[model samples]
Target: MYHVVLGVDEDEQRAESAAREIANLPGGSDEKRVTLIHVFQDNPSGASATQVASVRDAEEVLKAAGVDVSISEASGDPADAILELAEEDDADLVVVGGRKRSPAGKALFGSVTQTVILNAGRPVMVTGVPTEA
Candidate 1:
C-alpha cells in the first residue's frame, strides 16, 4: 500500500488524468491503496483552490479503477507541501502531473515537479503532458 500523490492545480482535467494514470500503476489497483493530494500556491495573500470538483471525484476515479482512495487539499508552496506530506505519510511514490511550459513560462515561473524530484526522498513518477495547458 504505497501512498500516491495526485498534484491537483485547479485544472480539473489535468488533475483527473494524473490520478487515473497513477491508479493504473502496476500494483496500484490490485492493492487498492492510493491517495490524491492537491497543492495550492495560496498564501502570502490568502488564496485557496476554488472547488470545481469534490473530493469524491478523486475517490470515485480511483475507486472505479479498483483502488482505495485517501484525499487531501493544501495551501502553500506547492513543492514544499507535497514533499512534506510524502515524508509524513511515508509515501513510497510521489506521482505528479508535469506541465509543459513554454520557454516564456519556464522563464517566468520555475517547475514545481522539478524541484520536488530534486528534493523528495521517495521515488517520484511525473506524468508529462505533450501539449501546453
Candidate 2:
C-alpha cells in the first residue's frame, strides 16, 4: 500500500506523473491500495471544482493501472499533514510529486518536498515534473 501526497495546486500533468510512477512499480498487478491525499492550504467551504478535478484525474490514472484507490482531503501544513496521515495509515511507502527547483530557490523557499523526504519514517518516492525549456 502507498500513501500518495499531492499538492492541490500542482498541474494535472505533474500529478499524473506521480501516479504513473506508482502504477509502474513492480508487483503492482496485485491490486495494491493507494491512498491519495491532498492538503489544502486554505480551509475552503468544501472541495473546489479544480481540487475535485485533480483528484479525479489522479484516481483515474491509478485505477486504469489496476490500483485500488481512495482519496482524502485535509487542511494544514502540507508536509506535516502528509507525514501525519502516512504514519496514521501505516503506509508502506510515501509518494510525492514536485517540480525541480534551483538550489537557491529551495533554500530560500524551504520546500515541502524536502521536509517530507527528511522526516518521513518510511520509504519515499519522488516524481519530478518535466521542466519547461
Local distance difference test, candidate 1: 0.70
Model 1, total clashes: 0
Question: Worst 10-residue stretch by lDDT in candidate 2?
Answer: 1-10
Count of clashes in candidate 2: 0
> Which 10-residue window of candidate 1 scores lowest in summed lDDT?
47-56
**Clashes (N, CA, C under 3 Å) per candidate:** 0, 0
Candidate 1 positional error at 95, Å: 0.8
In candidate 1, stretches whose alpha carbon ends up further than 4 angstroms from where it belongs are 43-56, 104-110, 130-133
Q: List the residue pairs that clash in candidate 2.
A: none
Best by lDDT: 2
lDDT of 2 by residue, 92-122 (tens): 8888777756876765324777788899988
How close is every model to the real structure, measured as TM-score? 0.77, 0.82
